[model samples]
Target: MQITIKVLKGSDCTLEVAPTSTILEVKQQIETELQISAANQKLLLLGRPLNNEQTIASYPNIKEGTKLNLVVMKPCLRDSIQRGFRKHYPEQQAERLTNEFMTDFEKKLNEQSLDDLERFADSIVSRATT
Candidate 1:
């Protein structure tokens, strides 16, 4: 049976897949349509996790016109920070650049008094308004 897949934060699509088609196969098709890697996609119906190796026929909740949400998994905090910095600064030769920066920044923040932290927040707000 055909089904429409809706991504939580991305584009919606459809697949003309059979009820016997494996979930992994569905993910491959999603990867084709959305360009999101299968590793990052999670197809869910009514909050129940779908098994990658299971066929559509295995799930009674999924059928034609059924809306399955695609949730892209987020990397860990360290990976996110590293990726963010790498995306903006390609020339940085440091391997653990974001980790180093975040460690030092966290240390500084922990060392600051509560009043100083409040002032830091105020400064951020002032900068945004200016």
Candidate 2:
């Protein structure tokens, strides 16, 4: 059997696991993939919490290809802050770089505005000649 998991602060991944695998074992695999502690991760099977000792075979009523969502809840305010930082750091970096580039571009445009039309034409002609 196979299972699909969406981990919080992690990517959506799929694992080709055995039907007899315990919930703990599956969580261990997810921990290895997501690089987070499995102890903090919560596994929900069919909208119900699966105890640490629960096994996949316990839920024989559910069909194969069942979708499972794994969530990692922040235990405290500090953990939430850390997770927020990790999530937004790349976006903040991109925004800063874009602002810098836009500033430089605007400065260049402002400097170009002082040039006369004739100078602009001459520059274009020189480029064509080159």
Output the number of the lDDT-best candidate.
1
What TM-score should be assigned to candidate 2? 0.52
Question: How many backbone clashes can be found in candidate 1?
Answer: 0
Per-residue lDDT for 1-130 in model 1, tens only?
7799989976789888898999999999998988886877788989877999999999988888898988989766666577678776763643468868889978997899999989999999999999
TM value for model 1: 0.58
RMSD of 2: 14.3
RMSD of each: 4.9, 14.3
The residue pairs in collision within model 2 are none
Which residue runs does candidate 1 get wrong by more than 4 Å?
Answer: 75-130
Lowest lDDT 10-residue stretch of candidate 2: 76-85
Runs in model 2 deviating more than 4 A are 8-10, 61-63, 75-130
What TM-score against the true fold does each predicted structure earn?
A: 0.58, 0.52
Q: In lDDT terms, how accurate is model 1?
A: 0.84
